[model samples]
Target: MTDLVQQAGIKLDATASSPEEAVDICGKLLVELGAITSSYADAMWEREQIFPSAIGMGFAIPHGTDESRAHVIFDQLVFVRLAKPISWADDEVTCVLGIASQGDGHVELLGNLAEMIQDEDKLAILQNSDNPEEIAQLLLGND
Candidate 1:
């Protein structure tokens, strides 16, 4: 979606035993994209401790804390599909949308994500699709 998500950022069949591990993996992707520094991942974990990111519909959006926005180089998103569902706070999450955004960019991203979650057909496709392009298209509202 939006140029923020590249095929490289769409990770499929990734494995993480815990929420922290999943968040760390997401942070690594953001760092690889040059969207954020390493500390931003830690910030995500800290934020998770205070408030879980799980938004139901089998997805969780993880992002840096407000203060950690300093580590952000730009606005970007990394989508991670886990090999197995992991318990995240009160929900079991199979997908993670990691965000590294400056200013209020993340708010818009979250809003878009909320809308996406309400689309059961798209959500179903995202849950089962292994093709990065397909997933990207769905996320971008092109499919």
Candidate 2:
């Protein structure tokens, strides 16, 4: 597990209802959590019309790789939770991790994130925690 994923990463909430709603919710969540610009939350909805960033894994990792954000330091892994159930094309994911990354390193970061999710202990811990900080610690404990 990476350090960022443990501290200011995996543990969060958005109270949204769908992947589309999650985009804005996640953006505001980052601002609330003090990790992203206020405008970042609204960025996803605009870009989704071009190419949907919904990646399935009982999770939807949305992002903005659009032209405007091209040169910004967009390396961030944010968390979002639907206030109600949301369906991805592949599966219904209650949890979403919205990544705003602009570097090739995201490939490796994604692999690690997958590994973190796959770990049985980590999975159970995160699944059981209501508090985001505990969830984050559970995710990072493996590291």
Candidate 1 Cα lDDT to native: 0.87
Q: Which pairs of residues have clashing backbones in candidate 2?
A: 16-83, 27-41
Write one digit per residue (lDDT tens) for candidate 1, span 1-143: 37877888999999999999999999999999888998987899999999999989889999989999999998888899999999999899999999888887667657767888788887877788989998877776677
lDDT tens digits by residue: candidate 2, 23-99: 77666555655555655556766666666666554566776645535533545566655545576655677677766
Residue 70 of candidate 2: its Cα lDDT? 52
RMSD of 1: 1.4
lDDT of each: 0.87, 0.59
Error of 1 at 77 (Å): 0.4
Model 1 compared with the native: what TM-score? 0.93
Q: Tell me the lDDT of model 2 at 125.
A: 50
- TM-scores for all candidates: the values are 0.93, 0.69
